[model samples]
Target: MTTQLLSRWKRSAIGSQLCLDLRSPQAYQIRHVAPSTNIPWQQLSLRCAELPPKNVPFAVIEPSDQKPDTCSQWLIERGWQCPYVFREDDDTFWTAVEQYSQPTTPKPWLLFRPCPFLMQHINWIEKQTQQHRCLDIGCGSGRDVAWLLSRQPLWNVYALDSLKGAVERTHQLTKNMGVHDRLVECLQAKITSEGKWKTFDEDSPAVTAKNNTTATAGTSPTSGTTTTINNTIAITNGDIDDKSRRFSPGVSTDTFFQDKLGCSQFDLILTIRFLVRSLLPQLPQLLAVGGYLVISHFVEDGVHEYEQPRKDHRLQLGELAALYGSMANIEIVVDVIEQIEDGRPVNSVVIKRTGP
Candidate 1:
């Protein structure tokens, strides 16, 4: 594969293909193929979102000592299409990088837009001077997380997602935006009933922590913060929070959050485009007094072309208002079904935990 890739590079200008140098930044700075982006091999999983669409073909430049097979397999598994692998040690490869090093017009990088609902209502956070904590549930791709970090310098953002890939993408996106330092953590665990989320896979570590703390199985750090795999519970069609009118007392939801998230409460809690009826009861418990909770997703009556949410997952009309309205110490800030330009109706609600 290296020989063939080198042959192709020699025949055509190296500028023709999108090249990703998998070597470390230090090594890449010393010497690397011209017009190549440096993303270390180990960071590839987290930073994979920075790459162009999976359909676009690209080349991988790896360290001379390692086999290109590993790099190729990793890219393929991530849905990245056909990759051309080359080693830095190859004389032909080095010569081609130098010979055809002239810069080519760069391709447009992919753009990620933040959630519109969050953008409109999140103005209050930026006005405050004191540092605050925020939690984003189902933080797919981390657009909102990155936006919050970029917009408010004093806020420490935490992200959660059930999928490992989603967590990785969120981490990488924040890192790319240069706000990763303020990103408290990204948790790869499903929001099961209270403490039901247990580690099912220890082979893959759940998080990268600071100061020797880790979410890997069997090791309980004194800090009470932990991580878990994407283990999920049964999704019921009925609204348990509405029916019960109060969260169950058995599981002790606060303990689960304290141990998993490291913090028992957040100033702002958001779950966008994600619906789990049973999880609704847990949001208020996760919010501190005077903090806000936001929920937005497709509604059952919403007319749209997209499918797969199923009737069970979509929120019923007035469901958000009814559920949170009856709950004590809760105030509904905003509750309405908004229609975007695409004609899709989204049920959005914002509420504040007014009392303990």
Candidate 2:
């Protein structure tokens, strides 16, 4: 393999390219290239968010003596531009591997940052050094929750998500950080406006990875007909008995909060990249007086079309400002469509509950 790219990267400025060593920790510790962060290939999905934004180019070092094609493709699918994946036996690169050590200081990009809107008003958060409660709705992968816990020692975080994988990931992240005790609970829940509720049969066999049979049943809860999960169901994070404990996917947000969360109030409630319009009206009730509501999600931009999030999932331009600005109890602090680091536009709003 050619060392032209590797040599150029080595000679370039410090921040020119991020070198990711997708190797086992044991192998990397013994001998690894300079300026590379060791993120094992198996854990890539979980750790990818900690890497630099997708726009930054990467040079991947494959695990063992394996080819880099698969690892490179994974990055590409996630909007990353990986220019090179170093071969294990590349003599030129391997010769200088142990010469340099990984940097002692944490790279800015590797740090899990909260949303920009929150950082902009970090002074407000810092002021609340005393005990406070924060709720993270749709806490996917738990980065934001983990960041909040790490940011303030006295603050307790309650994270809620619909997916089992999300809850497990959040738990794992918090546990790994040694802040799991402060994380009140990462509840697996779906917030909805529909009134229908159903119970899954606990007696049913847990779906095995190999079998991959989806559970479908007669009498659809929504339409009073039949419904089915067509493809393979990937719900291995929890057991079949755990299925019985889940709230019906159609329970209203208000109902779930009351029943599951004990109608608790929060000093800060964050809903990032997840939108449920019906849940907006209940925010004032759930938030304590003087609490802040931070919402950052994709908005309907006239110029672009997105496949996920759908049209209804996004807020119309100035929708949040218009709605919250008129609320007598809520004060619109910041309402604007900001282009984030990756160039996607998100309507970030920070509102405070001024009255009970």
Candidate 3:
């Protein structure tokens, strides 16, 4: 398409269209776009006639790392009026010079494979899944969600990530792929830590008269602590019962997070990067009798001071899966994955809770 038309095509305010690299006599052709009439850059002298007329103000997007000036020079010599130039555009024609040269895909590149670390889990997802009530808990770029949805558009999916940027990006990706209504449920809720929460003072002059806000649940601002020295009240929900409870406050669904995922409970819960101990125990309860829990993260070798993941709030040992192994009704398949990134080897574990 002409550059003018390309620019006018609304940015979609979504995500960029991702495509395979194309080069030479043939290229990665989409169903809608015709086969690109591409010839090697070296033959520009002979290939000049194959291009558009000289009067057409054509535009070209060069791979930021490739040679654009050289290609522009050749086009000019052939009487082509190529008036526009772009230093970076990974999704488009890249000077036509790199029809064969492919050390890698262009920069700011998304992973060619979505679930690289857990191919087994992906395969299991494809084979064992009866319904596509899939939830990608930490979908970075919607790759897995897109891949699965494209494989089965009828399946229901909830794509979520903690990072707002990633959630929006995934939402855009789903929209761009025409799966907005099928596989896109972008949310910003985060996994609450299992750490103990204590109440803080809610009284003193800071307590409002008009707002009608008071100490909720198990906590009310202590009178003596109003000086900010001795006051202590725990985090409480804005409910009568909340004021009665003293610990693990907040409007968190620590008990039934999975039930609130969708209509009932998601058949598949995909989590990466985040970890919580209490969540692990209830995961089995969240699933239908035969629901699957697929998880992957970096594992510790027992050498670290704490059995904690290096950066994220992930598990240290691969025992989190084994934590539920004692339950005979569930099938626990847990093991360490291959080391491909900068850290120690990762781990992927799946637990399919069965009926007794």
| Local accuracy of candidate 3 as per-residue lDDT tens digits, 265-345 | 656777765566655665665566666778776666454344445545546565775587777688876555555344456
Candidate 1 C-alpha lDDT tens digits along 1-356: 55566557545542345677788878887887666677788887766656645655677787766775678777889787544777767777676567656553232222334667887888864453244789888898887787788763468888887655567778878766677898998976554444344322334432233323224344333323233212223121222221112112233456657776688788898899887677897789888888888888988774565565777778889998998999999999899888643466789988998899
Question: What lDDT would each prediction earn against the true structure?
Answer: 0.67, 0.68, 0.49
- Top model by lDDT, which number? 2
TM-score sort, best first: 2, 1, 3
In candidate 3, residue 46 scores what lDDT?
35
| Cα deviation of 27, candidate 3, in Å | 15
Q: Of the pair 1 and 2, which is ahead by lDDT?
A: 2
Ranking by lDDT: 2, 1, 3
The 10-residue segment with the lowest total lDDT in model 3: 223-232
Stretches of candidate 2 exceeding 4 Å from the true structure: 1-19, 29-37, 45-51, 68-70, 84-114, 152-155, 176-178, 194-259, 301-303, 340-344
Clash pairs, model 2 backbone: none
TM-score of each: 0.57, 0.71, 0.53
Off by over 4 Å in 3: 1-111, 195-260, 302-312
